[model samples]
Target: MSAIALTRRRGRRHSIRRPRTGFLLVLPAALVAVGLFVVPLVLAARMSVSDWPLLGEPSFTGLENYRAIAGNDLVGQALGFTAKYAAVILVVLLAVALGLAMLVRRPRRGVGLLRTAFFLPAAVGLTSAALLFYELYFAGLSPVDDALTGLGLIDRPIDWLGQPGTAFLSVVIMMTWRFAGFYMLILLAGLQSIPDDVYEAARLDGANRWQTLRHVTLPLLRPSLALCTILIITGALLAFEQFYVLTNGGPDNSTVTLVIVIVREAFSFLDLGSAAAISMVVLGGLIVLNVVQLLALRRER
Candidate 1:
């Protein structure tokens, strides 16, 4: 062959081999996803459409479980509570995280230490953090109550998790402490990605701190903000560990989240079919919410 034709043949062979190599590299991850996620999702869907007991052969039940969800008082209550909790957490978490990110985004003395301290709670496992807060919120052992009493704030120890409002507030506080630092890190990264030239131009244009933040910083930080919002909303909607450990959905099932209700249905009541139906509903809701959020937050080309 001529030299040019030989080169073309070699290029064609490399292009063919490149796709095979890429597929080979991706094959393991695809298999793992199919086994771990897809398989379980399929099983759950099947269980949702059948009368699946905890320890019996599942019989097809059509949409009875889904239909039952409409009349279930607990499900309605859980949905309302979850929506409220998600809204509160989304606001609190984003505000706290943005503040922390702005606080530590500038390079200065002790900034590294501050960042570490802020992020420390995020490194702790969620269950472990919830357990720690559980102890801290307990009546007699709680130093918070002791301090308040010592300061003469109250004649009695306040039941931090004993009532619906207090329980909700306590869970929100714990969640903020646990997740604020992580979201701060995300925002900080976003802040650092903003070019210094933009700030300098804003300053030259006589923009004050608030003006710069509102006009320049916020517009640039949209991606990070969107990510944090999505994560906060999703996590709050699916919250279980904090409420379970701190309140046990307690004093009157006031803090029962959707996930908690699903667990109760599955293990506590041994009604796997109903639990699966709830799970599917939650899954659908999450998918829809995420899609809406993405559409709302999509950056214009």
Candidate 2:
């Protein structure tokens, strides 16, 4: 009809064609998310509402599992222990990782080697690392025990994972060793990204190392710290392998984490509905925590 109308129609056609290529490229990933994540999530939600035994017909239960969750003492203990463990591990991991990051952040001859050494444990599978530590803890007449005894650290061989306190501590040490390096890499990247001019300005302002770190470096590193905090908290809350392998929820089930509680409900006890309900609770809690963290950070920004 008109020249402008024709031009507008052609532009709309080109815009539609342009989006097709990107949409096609993203289709595979979308399908994967729906199949792997969305479908299982929906199924789990359904199972949570039904009495789904391991080998029985599913029947509608309608909030029975959720009701059980309220009166479950084991679940309460698991959540309490998990919270304490998460808090302790979060503090330890942040301190250790930050120390490692600062150590290797500066240019030095052996810096690469140090970074590699710190991060090498993270490359190993978590289960593998847990098993390895389990062996070390139980290895009888070994050098560790011998050295400790020889140095008068103990009167005799000590079972590191025998007591509840020591067993929890052992897991914490193993987790810190395994994950500190990974977080170090993240913090180191953040450290490197900080503009040199900022540090120069700090120095020019006569701010000493500690003062500069307290004022400038920490403020700049908040985002990375937040990420590391979230990861460490989530991992600690979901801790399963180390405690499962090492403690087996032993010492009167003192080291049972929230994830272990879920696994026990589902597989160990063959109560899928209860497990699904617990999982939903965990999922909701995590979502709330992450949302709060993001909102707090956004407000600060």
Candidate 3:
């Protein structure tokens, strides 16, 4: 080949090589996602369609596991309970966190210490927190019941885990305690991100405190709101530890969640097929809900 033709070919190869290098650099994370998350989900789907036990050989049953769970009353009830639990915890935790953030966003005396105190529970492991609450809500030594009775809120100690209605509320209280402070930090970050000039202008316009919060504070904190909403929703949807430690799906199964049912199928009953089926359902539900949420938020943007 001619020397000029050789040089042109070399330039072309270099151009191709540089772009391919960038693509190669980006490929690792893509490969990780497909290998770790996507592959397991695909395998779970196949497992859900088969009659597999924990110890036995699998046989393709063609939707039998799905049909079994569909007809299972306990599992259906668990799904409803999980939804209710998520709703209650989401509302309570986010409301309390936002309130706390608004109150403490401005530094006061010992404000840093105070924030740390509020957030201390989040540092504790979730299982430990739940177990602590479990002990407290039991009988005789429970500070929660004692406080309630001391405050004239109740005449006697309430068996929080023994009763269905109270069991659900107890779990909500624990979850709110564990998560509120973490969310408070997130919201305070959002609050602080808003320019002081915005509040200054609002004050100059003779706006009251509520008016400033409604118009200025919340509008600028939309991203934070979206973030907290996603965290609370997803966490609540997969709740297992609190109920597992506190109620164990007791009090006539009122506190049973979908995850608890999945655990029971896989471990207690050795029904891997049904467990995988429920897991797939859960994975799909989360994807669909998050997609819808993202679309709605994008529109607002």
Candidate 1 wrong stretches, greater than 4 Å: 1-28, 139-143, 150-152, 299-301
Error of 2 at 59 (Å): 0.9
lDDT of 1 by residue, 58-105 (tens): 999999999999999999999999999989999999999999999999
Sorted on lDDT, highest at the top, how do the candidates line up? 1, 2, 3
Poorest stretch of ten by lDDT in candidate 2: 11-20
Spell out the clash pairs found in candidate 2.
none
TM-score of 2: 0.89
- Residue 238 lDDT in candidate 2: 83
Q: What C-alpha lDDT, on a 0 to 100 scale, does residue 8 get in candidate 3?
A: 88
Spell out the clash pairs found in candidate 3: none
lDDT of 2 by residue, 1-301 (tens): 9999878878885454677789999999999999999999999999999999998999999999999999999999999999999999999999999999999999989888998999999999989999989988888437878899899998888778989998998899899999999999999999999999999999999999999999999989989999999888888878899899989988899999899999999999999999999999999999998899889989988
| Worst ten in a row by lDDT for model 1 | 11-20
| TM-score comparison, 1 vs 3, better candidate | 1
Pairs clashing in candidate 1?
Answer: none
Candidate 3 stretches with Cα past 4 Å from truth are: 1-36, 139-156
Q: Which stretches of candidate 2 lie over 4 Å from their true place?
A: 1-25
Is candidate 2 or 3 superior in TM-score? 2
